[model samples]
Target: MQSAIETARKQLPKIRIELVDCYTGSAAQALIALTAARAVKLGDNLNQIIPKVNKVIPEAEITLVLDTLKYLERGGRAPKIGAWATSLLKIKPVVTNRMGHAHFLGMARSRTQGIERMIRTMRGKIGLNRVSAIIIHSELETEAKELEHRLRSEFNCNETYVTEISAVVAVHLGPGAIGIAFLPS
Candidate 1:
C-alpha cells in the first residue's frame, strides 16, 4: 500500500494517497487510490498533505475504506463519546491520520450530509473553489452518484468521482458507507 501510494505520489506529483488507517468494514477490495495528483504552479494545503504513508503492513493493506464508529465499538477501539455522539447527535466523523494515528476530523450526520460537512471543512481548510471530485463508496453506486452530483453542484466543481471503500475500511464501516476526496483551487 505504501509503495503504491509512493508511485501515485510520484506520477501525480500534486496527488497524494492517504490511506485511512482506522477500523472499518470495507474488506472487499485490496487496492485503493489514495489521491490523484494535479499540476500546479504552486503547492497548496491539499498538496502539502500528500506525504508518503509512513507505515505498511507485512501482508497487505485493504483497498476500500469503511466508517469507524461501529468497528471501534466492536473492537473496543473508540470510546463511548464517539459512539454515543453517533446516536445522540447523529455525528458521522471523517477519519484522518494525526501524527501516524487515526483521529476524528469532525462529526457528520447522513452520508450526503457528512459529505456536505466535509465539503464545508474542505472549502475552509483547503479553499477548494475550483477543483474536481472523487467519491469512495461501499457497494452503493446510486448514493455515490447522487453524492457526486451534489458535490459538483454545490462546489461548482469540474469533476465529481466515486470509488468503493477498501476492504480494510469496509470491515469497520459495515455495508452502507462512502466518502469524497478533492483538492483546492
Candidate 2:
C-alpha cells in the first residue's frame, strides 16, 4: 500500500492518499472501513476521518469458529496432525485475531457450542457497552443470521450486519466457517 501510494504521489503530488492497517481481516476490516465511510458521509475531512479510523483499530475484535481444520492444514497455517486430531474428535476450532495474529481460544464439540463460546468471549470483552457488529460466514447464511439474532439480544447493538465471507478469506477458512467482528462503544 505504501509503495502504491508513493507511485501515485509521484503523478499527483498535491493529492493525499493514506492507508490504515486494521491489523485484522474479514469482517473486522470491513467494520473499520464502515466507520471511515460513516465519518466521510457525515462530512469529515481526511484528517478527521483518519483519527476516527485509528481509534477504531484497537477496539475492533474478531472471533471465528471453523467446522474443520483441513483448510488451515492445506494452506500451511496448521499442522497436519492437529487437523487430523480435530477431525477425528469432531471438534470445532474457535479462534480470535489479536494484535494481527490468529490465536486459538478453545475447541467445541458442536457449532452451537462454538457460537456460545464466541458470545461468551465477546461479553467478557465488551460487558454492557453498546456494540456495532458484523456477522460473516462462508456458505452458511442461516447460521450467520441466527448468530446475528443472538448478538442483538445479548448486547446493546448500535448496528449489525450479516455478510458472506469473501472468496479469498473463504479459501483459508473453508466452507462452514462462521465468525463475528465487533466494536464496543
Candidate 3:
C-alpha cells in the first residue's frame, strides 16, 4: 500500500499522500479510509484531510471475540500459559487493538457474554448513537449479522457495514472469530 501511495504521490504532486496504519484491523482500516474519502468528497485538501484521518485512526476501535485460542497460540500471539489456562477453564478471550497491537482485555465464560462485554467496552469508548461500525467474521455470517444488528440497535448508526474477514486475517483468527470496528461520530 505504501508503494502504491508513493507512486500516486509522484503522479499527483498537488495531492498529499498520508498513511494510517490500522494496527492490522481491516475494519478499523476501512474506517480510516472512509474518513479520508469523506474529506475528499467535501473538498478538503491534503492538509485538512491529514489531521482528520489521523484523529480518526486512533479513535477507531476493533474488538475481537475469538472462538478458540488455538489459532492465536499457533500464530505465537498468545502466551502458552494463558492459552492453556483459558482452554482448561473453557473461557473465551476478548481482544482489542491497542497501540497497533492486539491486547488481551478479559475472558468470558460463554461466547454470548464475551460479545456483550465487547459491546459494552465499545460503548464506553464511542458512546451510544454516535458511531459508525463495521462487522467482520470468518465463516460466521449468522454471528456477523447478529453483531451488526446489535450495533444498529445499540448505536443507531446508519453507516454500518457487514463483511467477511479476508483470507489473511482468517488464517490467524480462525473460524468463528467475530469482530466489530467503530468510529465515534
Candidate 4:
C-alpha cells in the first residue's frame, strides 16, 4: 500500500522541498545531534559558543539515517554494557536525537516491535492525528512499508512513502537502513 508521505507528496502541494545532507553513525550523530544539548563545554563557553552553535543548528538539522544501535556499537560509541546486554537478549535499540545527538530510545526485539516503538514515539511527540507530512525513506521498500503501515493505520496518514537513501546518507547508514523524518506541526 502507498504510504502517508507518498500520498501527501502526490496529492498535496509541494513545499519546495530539498533533500539535504544525511547523518549517521554515533560519532557523527554525537557531533550533529541537537535534541538534548548540554552546555558542559558549551555552558562554560556559553557567552562565546551559544551564538556560534545557534548559527549552526538550523543548517545542522541533519536528516539522520537512523539505524539500529548495533552499527553504533561496532563503531565503538555505544557503551559495551548496553550493546552486550542487547546482544544477549537479541534486542535492537531504537535510536533518535538526544540533545541533538544520536542516542538510544528503547529496545525492540523484532521488526514489528520496532515499528510500534517508532509509531509511539512519533505519536507522542507529533500526534498521529495532526501529523502535517511525513518523509519515509529506507534502504528497502519491504521494511519501509511497516513504517508506512503504522502511520496509515494509526493516523490515516496514507500519504507516507518510500524513497531511496542518497549515496552520502548511505555512507553512514550503510545498506538496509530505514529512516522516517517528520516536520513539526
Candidate 5:
C-alpha cells in the first residue's frame, strides 16, 4: 500500500492519499471504512478522519461461523486432517479476528448453535454498551436476516446492517457461512 501511495503521489503531486490497515477483514473492515466516510461526511478533513479511523481499528471485531472446513483446507488455510475431522463430526467452526488473523473460537454442532455462540461472544465483549453492527453471510440471506433480528433484540445497537459477504471472501468461507462484525459505540 505504501508503494502504491508513493507511485500515485509522483503522478499527482497535488492529490493526497491515505491508507489504513484496520487489522481485520470482512465486515470489520467495512465498519472501519464507514467510520472514516462518516467523518468526511461530517466535514472532517483527512487529518481529522485518520484519527477517527485509527480509534476504531482496535474497537471493531468480527466473528464467523463456517459450515465446513473444506474451503479452508482447499485454500490451504487449514490442515486436511482437521477439515476431515470437522466434516466427520459435522461441526461448524467458529472463528474470530484477533491481532489481524483468524483465531478459532470453538465448534458448534448446528448452525443455530453457532449463531448463538457468536451472539454470546459479542455480548461478552460489549456488555450493555450501545453498538453498531453488520451481519454478513454467503448465500444465506434468510439466516443473515434472522441473525440481524436477534442482534437487535438482544443488544443496544445504535445502528445495524445486513449484507451479503463479498464474493472474494465467500470464495474462502464457502456457502452457509455467517458472520457478525460489531463496534461498541
Candidate 6:
C-alpha cells in the first residue's frame, strides 16, 4: 500500500498527495477511503478532505468475534498455547482494532454474547450521530446477517455494507468470524 501511494505521488507531483495511516483493520481503513471519496465528491480539496478523514480515523471502530484462534496463532499474532487454551475452553475473543492492530476487548463463552458485547460498545461510542457500517465475515454469513439487521434496526445508518473478508484477512481471522466496522456520518 505504501509503495502504491509512493508511485501515485511521483506520477502527480504538482498535486499534493499525503498518506495518512490509521494503523487499523481493513474495514476501518476502507472507511477512511470512503470518507475521502465522499469529500471529493462534495468538491472538497485536499485541505478540506484531510481533516474530515482525520476526524473519522479516531472515531473508527471495529469489533470482531473469532470462533477459532488458529489463524491468529498461525499468523504469529497470538501465542499457540493461548490459542489452544481458548479453543479448549470454547472461549471466543472479541477484538477491536487500535492503531492498526487487534486489541482484545473481552471474551465470550458463546458467539451470541460476543456479538452483543460488540453492539453495546458501538452504540456507546457512536453517541447520537448517524453512522455508516460495514459487516465483514469469514464464512459466517448468517452471523453477519444478524449483525447487519441489528445495525439497521437499532442504529441510524445511511448505508450498511456486508462483504466477505479478503483472503489476506481471512488468513488471520479464520472461518466463522464476524465483525462490524462503523464511523459517524
Assess candidate 5 and give its lDDT: 0.91
lDDT of 5 by residue, 1-185 (tens): 78888999999999888778889988898888989888989999999999999988999999999999899899998889878988999999999995498789999999999998999999999999999999999989998998898888999999999999898888888999999999988
Query: CA RMSD for every model?
Result: 9.7, 1.4, 2.3, 14.2, 1.3, 1.6
What TM-score quantifies how close candidate 2 is to the native fold?
0.94
Sliding window of 10 residues with minimal summed lDDT for model 3: 16-25
Lowest summed lDDT window (length 10), candidate 5? 95-104
Off by over 4 Å in 4: 1-68, 132-138, 156-159, 167-176
lDDT of 2: 0.91
Q: How much is 100 displaced in model 1, in angstroms?
A: 4.4
Which has the higher lDDT value, candidate number 2 or candidate number 3?
A: 2
Instruction: Judging by TM-score, tell me the better candidate of 2 and 4.
Output: 2
Please report the TM-score between candidate 4 and the true structure.
0.52
Looking at model 1, residue 97 earns an lDDT score of 33
lDDT of 6 at 4: 87
**lDDT score at residue 2, model 1, on the 0-100 scale:** 88
Model 2 pairs whose backbones collide: none
lDDT of 3 by residue, 3-122 (tens): 899899999998766776656468888888888899989999888988898777778888988877877888998888877887788888999996487788899888889899888988
Per-residue CA lDDT of model 1 for 39-135, tens digit only, reads 1224434435333211211111122123447666666667776666665665566664323345566665566556666666556644545654567
Clashes of each: 30, 0, 0, 23, 0, 3
Tens-place lDDT per residue, model 2, 1-185, is 77888999999999888878889888898888998999999999999999999998998999999999989899999889979988899999999997598899999999889999999999999899999999999999988998898899989999999999899888988998999899976
Over 4 Å off, model 3 = 1-16, 22-24
> In order, what lDDT does every prediction score?
0.53, 0.91, 0.84, 0.50, 0.91, 0.87
Better of 2 and 5 by TM-score: 5
The model with the greatest TM-score is 5
